[model samples]
Target: MTPEIVEISFKGNKRVPYFNPKEIKVKPGDWVIVEAEKGIDLGQVNKVGRLVALFEIKGDPKNIIRRAVDEDLAKLKENRKEEALAFTVAREKIKKHNLNMKLVDVEYQFDRN
Candidate 1:
């Protein structure tokens, strides 16, 4: 029997499998809150069921904390705004110092921890 796992996609094209111990009903394109290294994170559901089993899971998957709530979504939006501001600031600083670097993307952790 295959384990109940759901693939979640985060920023920076990062994807990871998370264990759905509670069997929370979720489908692709759904937003979910999941366990992060520190507090928690929000990601979009990419795949579920047998398709997820095809991927070689290396370690015990983290738990899907819950389906994203309204509060979580609000936080995500605020984080995006902060990320944009941070990106602009970083680009200005880099140009100020004339460093040979290119700014790509800026992301913020859900909990900001």
Candidate 2:
């Protein structure tokens, strides 16, 4: 049997391939939580199809962690709000400390460790 694969982009256009172990139905632009290198992460499905041969795959194939739920999206929004607040506070602290430094944009990580 041909193995199915899906392309999931973690950020921007950085798409990675994974094996669809269960073949849970999914479509492009679907928000899916995937097993990323740094634990589980949320990503968008870019493409879905089957590969010619199993050996044609590279590295270890990861399965979709699960389709994102309402709770997951809510948590993601809340985390984003908190991240913005933290960035603002960090900038303020730098000013208060009389430090001459310019702060840039902030990126939220998957595991945030």
Candidate 3:
């Protein structure tokens, strides 16, 4: 299937930034990858939409794209596993190294890809 170019927005402090899905292209029903603050995120397209032109934003909206595909979902799943593993390893390392810092809260994004 031909890949459809779309925009994926992520939550930010001031304004959300859009990501380009150059690695994979997807459809409304398929899962897609989105670059988030914490790490790569997985989401499905709920609607087919385009980026509205905003001169103040600067750059081209063409840089922002989104798509859905199976591989993207699989990769996201693997990334989650890896992230969990990394966290565990980090915790162990911290204890072993006796770091003074205390662990704070961990958050995960559930929507808006």
Global CA lDDT of candidate 1, please? Answer: 0.92
> Candidates 1 and 2: which is better by TM-score?
1
List residue ranges in candidate 2 displaced over 4 A: 50-58, 92-104, 109-113
Candidate 2: residue 31 Cα off by (Å): 1.2
- Model 3 lDDT tens row, 1-113: 32334444432322332434364444444555555555455555433435322313445333323454567656656656665776787788889999987654233453322
- Measured against the true structure, the TM-scores of the candidates, in listed sequence, are 0.90, 0.67, 0.46
lDDT of 2 by residue, 26-84 (tens): 88888787776677777778888853232356788788877888887776677677778
Model 1: lDDT of residue 49: 80
Error in Å for residue 67 of model 3: 1.0
- Runs of candidate 1 with Cα error greater than 4 angstroms are 1-3
Residue 47 shift from truth in candidate 3, angstroms: 8.1
Per-residue accuracy of model 1 over 1-113 as CA lDDT, tens digit each:
44589999999879999988888999999999999989889999999988998989998899998899899999999999999999999999999999999999988989997
- Backbone clash count for every predicted candidate, in the order shown: 0, 0, 4
Better of 1 and 3 by lDDT: 1
Candidate order (lDDT): 1, 2, 3
